[model samples]
Target: MDTPSAAPHRMAPSGGCPHADNARLLARGAVVPVVLPGEIEGMAVVGHEALKEFLAHPDVAKNARHFTALREGRISEGWPLLTFATVQGMTTADGEDHRRLRSLVSRAFTARRVEELRPRIEELTVSLLDDLARAAASDGGVADLRHHFALPLPLGVICELLGVEDRHRDRLHRLSGHVVATDIGPQQVIAANRELVAVLGEIAQARAEHPGDDLTSALIAARDEEGDRLSQQELIGTLVLMIIAGHETTLNLITNAVRALCDHRDQLELVRSGHATWGDVVEETLRWDAPVSYFPFRYPVRDLTLGGTVVPKGTPVLAGYSAAGRDRAVHGSDADRFDVTRPRRGGAVRSLSLGHGAHYCLGAPLARLEAGIALEGLFTRFPDLELALPEGEPPRHASFVGNSVLTLPVRL
Candidate 1:
């Protein structure tokens, strides 16, 4: 890709930057230095136009060959969760490999298949809301909505779709939390990953023994005309991917939506008063405070130029989705504001929340359906739902990849 002629700009040092404390500087419109763990140095693609171009580039591959420390012969050990994700899976593959894996999974995860889950999703949403209301009543009409609602809704939906037994939910949840935690030490992360993989392996083994109507079974039996199928490791990795990507991102989406609505009462009232649909609320929230803060570790197969900086081959590059969402150039001056009735650029809400191109999220349809149902159900059930905590005090999860409120204390 040709480099832009504009001089690269530096990102201001903000204590709140998610990845690193003194991370190298980069700007929304320019390519500049970025410091990542594992001694990986690279440039960040920030603004909407640059990010879109980076994601769609054919030569800027997603293969693990570019960023893995082991692949680069730099070191044997690196970030545990990142290493696990890059080792093998659809997220790290490119070209035919990605096509094959994505194709097989698509058979069971198609838009039609996701739409079929709406009734069940609504049922689950209502049940969780009922529990939240009861809990709030017992606790002086206050409850942590993140714990009771935002978190459980997606967990229930993904567990049902993946055929995970109820007995394993708590353990899986704990392990997944540790895996994504930014504050945890290396040993804890490694241990959590092992346990999570073991749980997924057991689930996969059970599915292989006796197939069912769930996605796991369908994935096991999925085959193409050439008889291509996911291998055993691929099966395990895909399940991990589905579980992590499927629920976690959606969980953050719901949490962020509720938080945004609470912060902007006028916008919440707009949705409540029927001026804006739940779909509008969800889309606006997605653009305003994207669920995934940063898409970590995109690397170039060869040295390449992005924006105005040269990104050497093998250096890790990150797509700052959170920063891009609020880029004033693309979304206008009020991009930082949360406006449900915010006009679309061209009758289309452009967002990278669900990703783009070949690696665009497979579970996006289900997430949208769940979030729409979830928001409608929560607000409709408790028309006067309000944040229990004062404004600007909600605690955030400290994770490099996830941007979510840790707890949403609310009064019904």
Candidate 2:
């Protein structure tokens, strides 16, 4: 593997075109200093080795409350969405707090639990495919596969797992859109977050009064050997985390995979010819066009040196997962090429798309299972699936965090 070039100091765009901005910085080297939203200065760590190390480092913390700037009141809470990303959740917690939250949630969201949903996932996939076929027939043999198929499967599965009421699904879905929207203003973000929190809080309260077999109910009833249980706030946060992380990322995974397959005819042919499995397509998509381009900000507790760069304390850093996924040093010079038959490294699923270290995605198994089933069913049902806009370009969600197509029009 070759070493990344020296880190560069650069100013990231204040807003708009974040993907392009990130791509420019990533091209500079593995580690670069950047100014994020609200003029927060930090380092962007790219490449496989550098990201892995950054994620695992003890001093490179996730708790924003512990950030030196926040502690000393150097910066106002200008970004309301930052609260959603870094408050009372496992995603932003550190040490014992994170361990306790993760432990409780893990009991309710285990691999066996996810595996049990496989049959139901398959059933839902078939149902959605049927709906897509009807939609295509009505729309002159063309339909937005993303809306009809990719988006709904994971949303339905997650709602079922969390026991979200059927009536509330639409509201939850809309609010979630605002939560992840890159163009939304700070006030709008806060408004969306407030509504989402209220809904989750109500659901948590209801689950407390009357428990059920769903994961939300299980979480409400869960207790450690020490009798430690989740607080009401913790419960709400956990449910929100599960819903957003569970379905949103999986939706992108499916959409991105489908788009990749459609764009690369040769790779698509390999899978269509039965020379590669759907699982291969899913993994390659994950590595080539990661669903979450950058993991949310991780703040350093103190000044630290990482990947040959000195990062100041309280700086908000993000692991550039999208760039690392295609780093030539790690995946070879052909890393930029999308190849479904790319050999697995030691038979381990190595992409940072799902995350790494202590904060590794708890919902990874479920996401992978859902995507695999979705792709297999989708292609098997519609053997003639092709991009409706082959001559046109697909628009991306305007998010630094989310790397998803706005719509994937297809002919079924």
Q: Work out the TM-score per prediction.
A: 0.90, 0.91
Model 1, range 1-412, lDDT digits (tens) per residue?
2244443333222113343321222232445555555444556776677778788877687776766454767643336436443646788888888898888777656888888888899889889998998989999999999889988889888888889888988787777777666556667767777788889989977877887888888777763223456776677778878888878888889988998897788999988788888988888878877888766667787887777567788766777777777777677777778988874345554787678888888888888889999999998888888889965766676665677777889999
Error of 1 at 340 (Å): 1.0
Candidates in order: C-alpha RMSD to true structure: 3.7, 3.1
Best by TM-score: 2
Candidate models: Cα lDDT each: 0.74, 0.78
Q: Provide the global lDDT of candidate 2 against the true structure.
A: 0.78
- Candidate 2 structure quality by residue, lDDT tens digits, 318-396: 7788878887778877877889888544644378878889999898888889999999898888877899986657777
Clashing pairs in 2: none
